[model samples]
Target: MDSANSKITVLYEAPQPEEYLQLRAQTGLSLKSLDGAKIGLANSIFAVILRQEDKLIGMGRIIGDGGCFYQVVDIAVDPAQQGQGLGKLIMNEITTYLDIHAPKGAYISLLADVPADQLYKQFGFDYTQPKSLGMYRLIAL
Candidate 1:
């Protein structure tokens, strides 16, 4: 039941809180909103959606500057709707965008939560080198 054949329409730069909520709920990610802000905090990003009919069933995004670095984040698909390759649909779009637009020699990275690493590998993503380390700083508001 791969969604690759389904009529899933993709979009870019979709800033909607409701859709972000649904994706967060499905992916079990920690997302909190202050005021009415959407999940967009990146100066440059590639966002894509998977819609069946008019409902958004899946989404993924890459965020970073245009020329120096990129991080693939927030790739989510409804849990009840897993195993349909909808995530693949979302990743394909994001990867295409990075391949076409990210500056040459820019370092692209992402933290794969678990088994999703396999999906990402299809899109030319990989783990960082042993000499390199990943770091993060939580936003405290």
Candidate 2:
């Protein structure tokens, strides 16, 4: 997509509480009220939401325990809007936020899904190694 046709808005302001439902549904990122509340409480949660007028076209977020470790999460753009680089726009915003806010020695990480790995690599993310690994437990709903 041409830059002229697409406009990306980066908002440092808090995520709208109500939008969580739509975000969760669209991104397939499991979000509960507790998770929402946790995001609300964090001192370092940065989010970027892309909108075409009133419709939300894309969004990305960074969440973590705060000072030492941070994780990129919920990076999604509508499938219809894919290939337009909206996901890259969202990542750029998140990268800026981390660059400005995260302190030295901070460990930033993300779990990429398939082709998205190529995108995240541009931002300096890498796979875990022999020293450690990415592990997660399924949360049965």
Candidate 3:
């Protein structure tokens, strides 16, 4: 995670809507409509984006009410950029943000996709399964 290239630039901000969509699409994260991307980026409690060679290479976000609850979302790195600890780079930025901002007893949560869940665990995240289950229903619009 900390092993990312020293020269890579990390910005504590969400990327533009079009750039966000492209990075997600490239990284196999779910695609979002232009309007949805715009709104989501605007609403991020905190965000981090990494760029190299003037291209968006990775990003992550935190979203939720300012207090009590927060969810980690949209952690992605371009497929071509995967396996280089870029995801960890993104997570590192996110946890740093949370540590500075989230209050005591704050509930930080994330829907960790398989394999990636391993990455989350390194940052002190764990599964709630066999005791609690994670579930979701996509909104239709």
Candidate 4:
């Protein structure tokens, strides 16, 4: 978990569209179109990237309407580089940004998947079930 001990580097910016798609595929996240990747990445409210020797190893981003609503998305780590605490490193940077930039009334949220939900919970995220539920349906262009 020590960047100083390895070639790993953490950057406070989103990766290029191609890298985004590659990482998502490597991590088994849903594939996103190139156009969607470019537009979505450019619109990130906040993003953190992990790199090793100039190669992207992990990434996470926050996108929203830029006022009161925010959602964390695109959290992915390269399969070859998993088990090194990179995911936590990305979340640390993200939570730091939110703590400073998010307004007092802002409600930041994320849709966690299975075991990954455990990681998000460490950053103060909680499930809103019974009282409310998360729903989604994808559309194609």
Question: Would you estimate the TM-scores of all the predictions?
Answer: 0.83, 0.78, 0.91, 0.93
Clash pairs, model 2 backbone = none
Computed on alpha carbons, the lDDT of every model, listed in order, comes to 0.74, 0.74, 0.88, 0.89
Tens digits of per-residue lDDT, candidate 1, 109-140, equal 98887799898888887778697777888775
From the highest TM-score down, the ranking of the candidates is 4, 3, 1, 2
Ranking, lDDT, top scorer first: 4, 3, 1, 2
| Candidate 1: count of backbone clashes, pairs at least 3 residues apart or interchain | 0
The TM-score that candidate 1 achieves is: 0.83
Candidate 3 residue lDDT tens string, 1-141? 233454567888999999999988887777678999899999999999888866788899999997999999999988877888888888988998899899999999999889899999999999888999998887653
Best by lDDT: 4
Ten-residue segment with the worst summed lDDT in candidate 1?
34-43
Off by over 4 Å in 4: 1-5
Report the lDDT tens digits of candidate 2 across residue range 36-75: 5455535447767777655666777787876799998778
Name the better of 1 and 2 by TM-score. 1
Error of 4 at 23 (Å): 0.5
